[model samples]
Target: MTTAPAPPSLPAHQQPGAPVPLRAVGPPRLRALDGLRLLAALMVAAYHYGGRDGEISDAWGGSPTHQFPTASQFFAYGCLGVQIFFVISGFVICMSGWGRPLRAFFASRVSRLFPAYWAAVILVTAVFALPWVAYEAVSPTDALTNLTMLQMPLGVDRVLGVCWTLWAEMRFYALFALCVVLPGATRGRVVMFCAGWTLAAVVAEAANNSVLDIVLMPEYAPFFIGGIGFYLIHRYGPRDTTGWAIVAVSWLLGQHYAVTRLWHAADLPNAFSYRSSFGIIAVVTVGHLLVAAVALGKLRWANWRWLTVAGALTYPFYLIHEHLGWVTVHWLHVTLGLPAAATLPLTVTLMLALAWCLYRFIERPLTPRLKRSLMG
Candidate 1:
């Protein structure tokens, strides 16, 4: 999201049976997470626009931008930002549900995700994709499937491709929702859930079924678990040393799994000696460190409140960026004859501005109304 994860923590005064609404739960927002959200969004943008030869040029009548300087491996590695998002989501979800009722947890998640997301979906489908049917011949079935954001696990396609992350987020929510269902049983349920899912992933790998691997998405589960461990440490502090050890192990597994998954995308394993490059390692390392720092209160200054805006823009930017920015890049570079230098930064700026507008006009305004309608 610029994932707009649920706010972390609950006020000490909030009682379990008090009927407090999720949004009304008085947790002081963790502002560092907001800044973290912004950073992850930028990484994904870099992945789409600057990765490899620059996926932007794929739209124009030319090859990837060899001429553009920043359009190098830096951008290519940015796709791992999605992994960072997954981990952050785990932290957000855990923190949001920490002391709240089960239903409140679900409601908070819905309010945070759906308002901005639904707005982005309608805009992208109607304004952009529908107009291209003459060439693309879109299927109504595929179109309808993505609206649920359940498409991937349901074996359907996403209306917006970047929305693939939502599918994973949804899965994480589905699994983590167990953590709240029975109140007293929440942690036990979550531990069992993660273990079962992780085992399923192992069996899928053993069976050598690529499809099954994608279906379970176990590789990403470690990141989510790591996030959970982080919440334990942040909330319980040094008393949760076991949580820290678990998180450390989970991070290692998550990074290893991430490299294997990313290599396939980059079409690696050509020689088999060393599959991943430095960029892959850096993305994994830096993302993990950032979360660790936040959990340990190392980035306490990030809680300054203003950074919330950056965090807020992340989701909309992520949703609209790939397709819209790609189209804009094509138009600017090919039609307007702009160079990559101008086109890339312009695309980023325009998308960022649009993301802010979405937050300002669509997200912030609709959030309360949507919460009342959907959660109330």
Candidate 2:
């Protein structure tokens, strides 16, 4: 699931030679980003429901191509939503982390990530443990390890497949915290970090080094790097050439990596075979363009009041949607004799309701207390 805190106040742009300060009244909440995040989460849910591989198909008792047909063709590309999320993450992280101390930054991250995550791990584990559910449940030890969000490095399977993205976000946060936040995230330092990460990712891929690939995340580094660049442009002004250059280079590289990765996945026996690599490339391009538009302030009109609530549901919705949604689909469509049309909407409604409860009841009460404890 894509997750990050709200953007913090930002210092305004300075004269070319003047030093930039750390704090000032920043722009209004990018409700548009919240809206974009919700859309991304929905896209991912759509993919898992009808466009993924044999799991959803197995649950539904029919091939996705035969079952979803036209919709599957579109939803097949929804995995690209994660790319969109990474880009948003970079932008939000840079915005939030700017001018904050390392302790405050670290505290905010822990508070934001763990409240819902711990709950989701236990909840998804319990759901999978139901006797009627077909999805295999992980051992209690793995589930406990998952609570720390270190399961990826520890060689444990994720309780929810979407947790993998949370792991990626964690790694990005670590790199940012040490390299940027710990030292202080000034404009120059942030730009340098982005450039350095982009270069290292390239080297890691060229050398085929497993360790560097894991650390650098060549496939996803561009999106996060580009997001930092966008935040810089948003903070400094549109005339920031260095920021624009970083974004431009990142967009070019992001497309290449995305297409290459998707193409490689084409051979996977259990995964959805994409219809066209070119189509995948186009979708990735669109994802970059959308974030770029937000950076340029073109989407400011999308700042509707309800989007804040929409954003609140995104993370939890993503967390529970995969394993739990699939199981519900199996029970509803296959066992209950409901049609796909009715079953899909009903399942989504139920998931959204659960996400809201997770947010309103659990996240709302726990976040500030957790942050205060960590801060202390």
Candidate 3:
């Protein structure tokens, strides 16, 4: 992966007017990781509505397809990308909190995550609630829940519509913060928590409808726990190809099962039969391992300067493209009438352009300023 920019060499006893050399701090930059983020963002964007009629068909039989295997099945499996994000989040967040006090860790996380999210939520709600749009008006309770990032626990859907993942992330942050605060908690604590959370997910699934159901859903906490495990392994475990092999095998098995089942069940009206338990564990484990392999791998050509930049902008892209609204997709469908084959490429290109512009003009400059203000 691409290493961070090197600090300039400075001579000792330089003149007072001499420019000082900047020093690199924290962990070295990982370009491949950013590339992975770019891939995830693209997968999510394409999966949203980048096909004919702007809908990726589920196994429940939503639409007709020209081919024996449709693109929607691929997209359905692609939702694993979000789980990938959760794992990455766990690793990155823990690294950030390593050796830090709980207050500082919490502050840093809140500062990084909440500002952009709050802005997006406000902007989306305002745009959609316009009288001309005729979108459903969000109730006060919904707005409050979103603002507090507690909508998942409250059983209210995201006000920003695409922010359901944020609920999971916020919960993960809480659990992680607790780990940081505890006096005797080692890396093992993180593993135990993850295992416990995974078990809780299975129990919640079995129970069907209860408070535990919300907490233990694979979509909610398991991936985050997996990420924590990944961090522990990276920090303490031996670096070898064995981990990579296990990751690859798990990924293929999980992906194959999900795809085959979805494809076979496509004609069924209620195609939600595939269980999430196996897929969740497999994907989360594989996703982190893939990332770790790339980060620690010995590939000399893995570094790409631009990929790091793209990764930094990935979050903004995700936030923007996901909230473009059904109307945007409808407009494109009516105006262009593009076939499914053309939809994925076209939408991805457009979304990337928009995301890049937003990053360049808005998010990039603000991120450093916000960090300085918050951290300094």
Candidate 4:
């Protein structure tokens, strides 16, 4: 008697009678991951607020070091938060997109990314247009281009500094959708994609190939790759050797790139520089271990309901936080003459409140409508 084929929804390599984890195939919500996302957003916000080079000083007529002496020291490390965000994005995207249709994947990404991003661009442009604000206004043409989220490739300046990460994310989504999702994400195919991408990254680095570097994202690819491996472990159990190996190799290469590629040694006045390879490696390692812990079920205790709300706020908060937060900090501290002690917390609280409003009034309402239209 012939045996029956495995279901299409299951990984291609899943053996007959293999025990698929309920957590993998069930509802995709992981509250701990949601909470982690919010933490990452807060880290980025802190970096923008006090750890940046000279923007605070430019706005308030005092050095950031002087105003936020103790905080700046810690916040300086907060830029690593973006790396953490990228890793989370990898796991979340792979989890959400596995066994999904290509069009559905595209629609989900578009609906999720564009609404708050458009709102942010429009709001930021208006804010910068105010004569009292210290920053120059983004021109109408640039603002229009920014709404497309393709301004980086079009050679137009981003209206918000944080939007650069969105470009990286877009490229990743496109690649993953085509190579993995379109073909159907399976254990074998995903493992191959991860391995191929890893090799491509090393080749790009060694050959100084700009085209491959742009497509492959040599510096950031390992985190994304590792995240995918962790998800595979979560879905199929940690017994998978290839998945665990992929994660290990990614960590090795990721830390190397984090130290060598991220920081500059020059002491330019307005440019941020961090030369501590140890600190860079440590931060990246910690980020990896955090996600790995989640995969291994060590963070199951973190699944609080409020983390769902926290996750919703992360995207919009990240989208609007950098430039607008800077403006708010300047307005409160410089224009209104509030002390730095008061300005910092006030700015953070106000940004969080604004993030909620953006999510509730804009993203929550628009996402479904946009998804329906795109799917239709």
Candidate 5:
């Protein structure tokens, strides 16, 4: 007897008049990724406080000596958190955009990112800069740069003093948009684009030695590419084996970075390498391998609901806390004579509490409304 014919493949796009699927089949919720976001936020917070003493002084007003001698240096290396955020964003955005129209993808991104960003810029400039209006004049060029997310190239400071990453992310979005348009917006095209971007990032890292170069180079592309690669593997590969691998690898690399003093050199194997004269190809290859391993080993947990909330708040927290948290910590340390050791936990708690408030009252409410108005 002949077997019944298999069901026909779903159309790439639903017909104009046809009803769309109520529950579309796509990537599953990855709580581990949310947890990773939480971890990255914490790292960045710690990095700002523990490492960048100069920014801390400018934001707050005191200089507290390091009291925790055991792991102070290790904790000081918290700037790498931005790199983690970059990679994670790449993966999530790519996965979300896969199989979707380029216009829809771009619309969704603009809806999610722009509302909070604009609000933050306006809020910060109005509240923080107004009181010192005579002393602090907003430069037209800087204002334009910050508003258009082109401040990094123009050497303009972030509006809130902690919004540099927004520029990097906006640039990545532009590049990805270009990729979608030029290469047909297919899954394979996205993959190819990521691969090419990663290679370019490697070369850029190797060629540029200045701090500006590090901030503006192709080195970041690999992290984003690594993220996209993770998404693809999660989407099509064996869930059980691949998921376990990702969780394990990410944890290990995180731990290694946490404990070691090895600086990331452009010619090195680590993710944040800065030296440029060394072998570029080998370093990039190793960096990519490490990132791939970490992405493969990420693990989802049942207790990640809180982390998911934290992750949602991370962007705003990154914007606010880098300055506010340091200010708070410094005030407490100087005014109350609190030791530096006490500042870490207390500051983290306060930042988290403030971030939660912003997420609940401001960002969450505005985001959906903006999305509906802009994209729906």
Candidate 6:
């Protein structure tokens, strides 16, 4: 859900005559993907705290009086936006480090993930557990476990539920990094690794073992694979129908995973009744279509300032939105006398304000330096 911006090399237009740093090289910006990132963050925030589904998103169809309207449906399925982020992450990770040294690749990814993440972790800890000046308190262990951002894998609960996605993201990074660091990276090898991984995931699912789900998180493999497939198609060429085929297969499997995870799983209060079987299919289909459109050069824009700003704020926005927003809503509606209807805008505005501060202060300033120090 969060992307650390990579250092940009100079634009071709300003390269020849201008004095630019020798080590400076920036990946070309994909404004459309950036826009998508912004949208995904907002969607998840809406899905979590903004929607009538209540604080927990899985309680989607619970509010009988509000019933499920079109707006409700949008909020209910908003977490699907994370699938969009996963696909984008695969694309971004590839685009960010094509042929770069493995060291540089690692440094870039570390820089992009941990600095802001750590800061967000600290802020969220204070807000959710250790509010400096006010509010109720939560477990200290949760705050500590969250600082690692590996709570699930570490056998500790997360300080924030949304952080589960980060573990999935980290696993994808580890797998992709392994591919990039092979003795001699080749298209076939990368393809083989991703395909093999997806196959393993399928097998794991088929085995019906809960342990593999906890350890591997293979259920999400298809999205990452689809992302890599699209990246191959874009970076190499469209004629690579092989890559296109992988993407297609991945999309199909994603829908399949959705069905089993959401529909067949006898979990949740209502079990299979929580969501329609078709809802998951629709989400996967639409997500891939967006990725396809982006790869086809359809969503390109000339880097409008507003879009750039929105994109810049995405990572921090994602980091701070969920728990903090819910806390704010509780304060406004429960603690204060404000009605639920009146508290929604205030909650959103408060989260945005907090995100802006985090981006400007911690995320923006510290990331490059942290990366540089690690590289040094």
Better of 3 and 6 by TM-score: 6
lDDT of 5 by residue, 241-354 (tens): 433343344334333432333345445552322322222233333344444544455453334576578678777677767656645765677667776777678988887776
Those runs of model 4 whose alpha carbons end farther than 4 Å from true positions after fitting are 1-24, 264-275
TM-score of each: 0.82, 0.93, 0.70, 0.92, 0.71, 0.82
Per-model lDDT: 0.71, 0.86, 0.57, 0.84, 0.59, 0.70
Clashes in predicted model 1: 3
Between candidates 1 and 3, the TM-score winner? 1
**Tell me, what's the RMSD of every candidate?**
7.2, 5.9, 9.2, 3.6, 7.7, 8.1
- Candidate 5: stretches off by over 4 Å: 1-24, 57-65, 130-145, 181-185, 202-216, 238-298
Cα lDDT of model 4 by residue, 110-161, tens digit? 9999999889888989988988777897778888988899998788988988
**Residue 161, candidate 5: alpha-carbon lDDT:** 63
Q: Which 10 consecutive positions of candidate 2 have the poorest summed lDDT?
A: 9-18
Where does model 2 exceed 4 Å of error?
1-18, 264-271
Which candidate number would show the highest lDDT if scored against the true structure?
Answer: 2
Please identify which of the two predictions, 3 or 4, would achieve the higher TM-score against the true structure: 4
Of candidate 5, the 10-residue stretch with the lowest lDDT total is: 13-22
Largest TM-score belongs to which candidate? 2
Tens digits of per-residue lDDT, candidate 1, 173-248, equal: 8666664443532344444555566677668878888777666676787888888777666664544555576578
lDDT of 6 by residue, 82-159 (tens): 887888887777666556677887888888878778887777667655533243434676676677778877677566
- Tens digits of per-residue lDDT for model 2, 206-242: 9999899889999999999989988877777677788
Q: Give the Cα error of residue 366 in candidate 4, in Å.
A: 0.6
Candidate 3 C-alpha lDDT tens digits along 254-304: 344334433443355645323254554565456666766754543336787
